[model samples]
Target: MSTHSISLLLVGIEGSEFRLAAEMARANGADVSTADTVDAALTHLRTHGADLVMIDICLDAISFLERMRSERLSAPVIACGIDAPARLAVAAIHAGARDYLPLPPEAELIAAAIQTFANRMAAPIEIEALVGHTVADVERELILQTLERCHGNRTSASTILGISVRTMRNKLRTFIEAGIPVSPAA
Candidate 1:
């Protein structure tokens, strides 16, 4: 958890990974709350404050983000989904999510997110990388990094990125055609 007693809200459909997130956050020393619907989450937010909110991307995440913005909710939200597509993840980011949490949540990843949000810091984001960069640019950069991290294995990269192998191939082709060097397959 982030520090001690940091409050966290996990909102999503019933039986989703949100439950695990709540458990993990709680186990990590956070005061965790759960809401099965966006409306309920918003209602709670209307009266309570949270250090971080982990919302399911499938739960009309964009609408929820818009509502949060309209309601002036300041809690940082991390969108979570099981095998969510890269496009949807990007859309969530564009809609105001600070980050996307991969489903079957990785323990360390969730912990790091909790710590970052609770501390009111975003060190993993590297703001210097976002300076005046377009979303497509960032997307491309991420794909390349994932590819490298996977030792040029497209399948592994696609899985990590929550994108289809076909999409990965297409992006790699595009990058290559654009003269952007991709690591040779290993």
Candidate 2:
């Protein structure tokens, strides 16, 4: 069963592709709507609440998404397009999109992404939920990358990461709890 009521607003020009995508999403039990242009979409957003908004990451899309963020739309959006560029993907995520996908996405991929987004939206945020950084996720990645850069030298890793030897040991303890294996260098 789906985790949440899946309603979506698909923003793209009127075309066979958009219609097909809309049908595909609806077939997966999503309540789907369409907006042929940016202004129309923004107006729709003001009146209707949707779980997701899948948009074409075209020139108009870039502008539309920026405006959405500036206007503080809270619905999680997923940008979709044919051969979307890496920078566009980064920009979309930064603009508060939950994820981005290529056009005509596989059924399973679409379903999985929708499920993941729903789960994430429903999950509670907790101090303990911060499994990264203070939970040693960031520190561990840095340690691994730095160790790799230092040719597996603990002293050099410490210098690169700007942490003392004892601090590194303390971090290792947290890293162990985070389930990251210590590199042989440590």
Candidate 3:
């Protein structure tokens, strides 16, 4: 796919990683925008059309993905961070991200990830992607159990899960991952 065919939103609090991602995106020919906060990123999504988002979930921006899915943003998102937890990565994909990659990512990896997300976004959501007893299901169950222990208080749940609130938010995305269908009752 041509990079010009897609718009990329690069989000992270002010830092070198954000700059690196933006530069890589530009080199790949993707029209790119930078957002310092999840709120700003959401505004950009509302005002401008983006094909994908490269996010630093380390800054606790995972909830932004959940909110995006909850709001029904059609564009695919990709979470990028260094040493991001497996749960967070899974949650991001579940929340509707086409993929996730570790930060300090190679330029080619970023480009490829973007291309893959673009391709996937162009297709219809496939129910077969959600099969019996997926890893997402197990993680969601764990998260729900933790939430119940915390009495639905996300802060407490995050503490119990040993992750940041942003990571917790990303985990919530798994509940909405395409055809996964994690219900409130689950």
Candidate 4:
């Protein structure tokens, strides 16, 4: 388990359900905050920085998610909706949601989601400490790992890393310029 506490933002969630979810998250070792609107969520995010965001499906979740991404809120988002249409769920994902859950979310699921996010958020820190590496070193290692996993195919690695092939090439160039050895493409 990570020593760092996981912070979570809940958008447009209220009532007894919100209370229960908040309690469950706290019990699972998370610090949680709430927002009633997109603007409020953004404000909370700017001030507190969340590892994960849970947006109520009723709050025009797709739009909120798009706005968050536009604002560079990199936290993984979870859309919580009640019997939402498949189209709506797909739209939410396209808008940058990492997961979608039914309304009145189950406590176990919420805890699991938070745990997953926490693990993701803790990874870089753990890597850095374990290897005594800088951010660039970690990034280079990750890119190389992805490239290897993709069989040295730049396009596939870039796609998996959510970067353009051009960007991947540029990063590789930087590594080469720094005299870092990289395996040739297969």
Candidate 5:
């Protein structure tokens, strides 16, 4: 089965707003869940590994962020509210929300919001993830990881790495000739 990126937790939004947000997120491939309070959201996060979080600004979102910090819940957060003032959006960001999503959801905006966070799912390259002891080894690993991130789509990985598709194909060929297993190109 194809994996969907949205394992979203919705907190404090109710009635039409909650339904709408969930529907929009689902329409854009999110597997959405809900929580009416901060404690409940925390409990859910602790139990279920996930995800991008969306909490209503009208609720005690700042408190949630503080508690999430104290509890070390590392999921990135997004704030949602109806007619929220500018200060509140700034405050949400200051409190560690990745972005704000205004309510009475719009599909395009939800897609954009999901895309913004989806891009962050690529983990940073770490020393431990690299194999072998040479600069060539690092370069090979980076290219392979980037290709994996792009789901074996050479064109996309090439664009991100600022290289051409021909070069990517050549590199993959070289790696394969060297007995390195590579993802099948899409």
Candidate 6:
């Protein structure tokens, strides 16, 4: 359903089911590749850098996930299995699968999972940006409060912050240069 083309790797799924799923993914603008084993899947992943990976639970999903993690693959992985029990799904999730699907996976579910992964990937960057901004704001406020509590004494503020007096002066200078108002030593 996404306009963006996703490069997907499929592991341990075959027969008409694989073909059907592959075809559906292709129709939804995904470039999909299939592998019959974990090693083969890893090879494809290392070489092609897939956007997403779908692994069958029968293929040792946990091991595959471990390998991917060890190799530092950033692609999101979805574990799928026919008649997969709740425990198996839990295991897949615990093993680092981003999502799980019952096989043969429905095209709608696959699309939704991929979209969810995309959203998840995007969220972290935004969250990190916000966190960085918030941390900077807190740092500025803390430094100002420390300076005020020290009665504008750089040495005392530095000691309290566990920083050198020179470092404290440099930080205060930075604030002043940034147009932040600071009270004179009293």
Best of the candidates, TM-score:
4
Best by lDDT: 1
The TM-score of predicted model 1 comes to 0.62
Can you write out model 6's per-residue Cα lDDT over 50-140, one digit (the tens) per residue?
Answer: 8888888888998998898799876778888888788888888767786678877688987776676555545545345446567768778
TM-scores of the candidates are: 0.62, 0.61, 0.59, 0.67, 0.63, 0.63
State how far residue 171 of model 2 sits from its true place (Å).
19
- Give the better candidate number (4 or 5) by TM-score: 4
Model 5 Cα lDDT, one tens digit per residue, 1-186: 124476888887457475588887887888889888888899999999467988988887888988998988889888988888889988887677777888777888888887776665654556675555688887798899999998999977785565778999999999999999998888
lDDT of each: 0.83, 0.74, 0.73, 0.79, 0.81, 0.77
Task: Please provide, for model 1 over 38-147, each residue's C-alpha lDDT reduced to its tens digit, 9 standing for 90 to 100.
Answer: 99999989889787888988888889989998998878888999998999999887677878888988778877886766666423557796989999999999999999
| Candidate 1: residue 106 lDDT (0-100) | 78
On lDDT, who's better, 4 or 6? 4
Choose 3 or 6, whichever is better by TM-score. Answer: 6
Error of 5 at 133 (Å): 12
Can you give the lDDT of residue 34 in candidate 2? 93
Model 4: per-residue Cα lDDT over 5-67, one tens digit each = 898888865673645677777888888888888889888887888888888777888888777
Candidate 2, residues 1-186, lDDT tens digits: the string is 465757788888887465577877777777889998889989999899677888888836667777887887767777887887889887776555656788766777677766776676677776564554463455567787787777767766775465776787777677768787777763
Summing lDDT over every window of 10 consecutive residues in candidate 4, give the lowest-scoring window: 124-133
Clashing pairs in 5: none
Extract clashing residue pairs from model 4: none
Model 1 alpha-carbon drift over 4 Å, by segment: 1-3, 121-186
For the record, the alpha-carbon RMSD of candidate 5 to the native fold, in angstroms, is 10.9
What residue runs in model 5 are displaced by over 4 Å at the alpha carbon?
1-3, 122-186
TM-score of 6: 0.63
